[model samples]
Target: MTGIATSCATSPTQPSGVAIEAEKIRQELAALTALYEERNNQFFSHLHPLLEGSAFFKESVQHDFETFSEIKMNIKITRLEIRKEDVWTSVYWEGTWKVISDASPLLQSGQALFIFSAESPPRLMETRGESPFGVFQKAGTPAADVPISTRE
Candidate 1:
């Protein structure tokens, strides 16, 4: 028997460098979450200018939002529900806004949605699943992976 037998097998070995990518993503997401919790208005307002630039602001959103109490009475997040995925999240929020604050306490309450990616340094904020006309969407269920159930 001058023949040789071959065994087909593979070896499992870890990569040389430890992967901190997941940790990094988590940290970034956490930071954004904290920012939303602490300085939500500032954080959100910054987005309009950064991504859309000055044009979208002056031509599109100008005279579109309200300001009161020395605060941009535009989009206010009342509640937030985070739906996390492998490398992204869907943020659903309840918001109250003053589109046109008249003599009376005219305030409209609604919802908002935001999709967050795991890319480095993050990406521009989006409101794809938000209402076109309504200032904000209902925080309870603003279209997310998880069912944003609410009570009566």
Candidate 2:
């Protein structure tokens, strides 16, 4: 079975495809978080090349940057898991976030769902549960989680 052996040898030895995808998404998230936390928009260009916009591009990416600047909130990804389907990959992610100027001394948790291409950069296709205030707000209702971060 030389042919079989050759094919096996040529194949990748990664543990799980989902894990790999999760890691890539993690990196991207980390970079974005750092930018917001640091409030440094000068480096925005670094993310421009990697941006893979889908139908929710404006609401998810563009508005996100704007919101980040408005509220000065920071994100820390706590967990991320990915599942692969026939034609798409779904990701569940949780993060600890807080406003830079808030009185809260500790971070709070928030989560979001994303569907991507399952390839490099993931090419974000869809997103759900993206709170503009970053999981922290006066009211704890899903609908009340407005897409605006209030500094006061």
Candidate 3:
């Protein structure tokens, strides 16, 4: 009975490989998000390459963003979900985003793109369409839906 209770109370641990990979993905997600907090053009400049090679980055068309030049743009990811078409093709994501720029805070959202294709590599992905979360339009899309104040 005690053994059963312990097993039920605590979820079985995942294999070491899965644990490690999951952690790696978490770290990657964190790093991608951190790019937004970077000042001036640092964020866009540094994160561009990472955003270019993913199918999900449908919006990160090469010529779209020369720079992620913003005065004070910050976004916090609120949700993330993943789906895959096959072992080689999978989708990585985020659900919510919040922005704190200059001197105010606003709730916004965004999605990212990635490709695990070793030869092609993965990108941070980009976004499109109007957003309700805030002023972050991934890499290629417009920020019109997002307030300009937040864009800066």
Candidate 3 residue 20 Cα shift, in angstroms, is 0.3
Count of residue pairs whose backbone atoms collide, per candidate: 6, 0, 11
Q: What's the distance in Å from true for residue 81, model 2?
A: 6.3
TM-score, per-candidate, Cα-based: 0.33, 0.41, 0.36
Q: Output the better candidate (1/3) by TM-score.
A: 3
Model 3 stretches with alpha carbons more than 4 Å out: 1-15, 39-104, 110-152
In lDDT terms, how accurate is model 2?
A: 0.42
**Full-model lDDT, candidate 1:** 0.34
Instruction: Single out the weakest 10-residue window by summed lDDT for candidate 1.
Output: 143-152
Clashing pairs in 2: none
lDDT of 1 by residue, 1-40 (tens): 2233222322235322113444443455455444443424
* Best by the lDDT measure: 2
> Residues 1-152, candidate 2, lDDT per residue (tens digit)?
99889767634665466566667776665665566455455324333222332223333434434433233444444455555631122333333333344545333334455434455665444344553222332333222323222112
Q: Candidate 2 — which residues are off by over 4 angstroms?
A: 1-14, 40-109, 132-152
At residue 125, give the lDDT of candidate 3: 34
List candidate 1 segments past 4 Å from native: 1-50, 53-88, 98-103, 131-152
Best by TM-score: 2
Positional deviation of 69 in candidate 1, in angstroms? 4.1
| lDDT of all predictions | 0.34, 0.42, 0.35
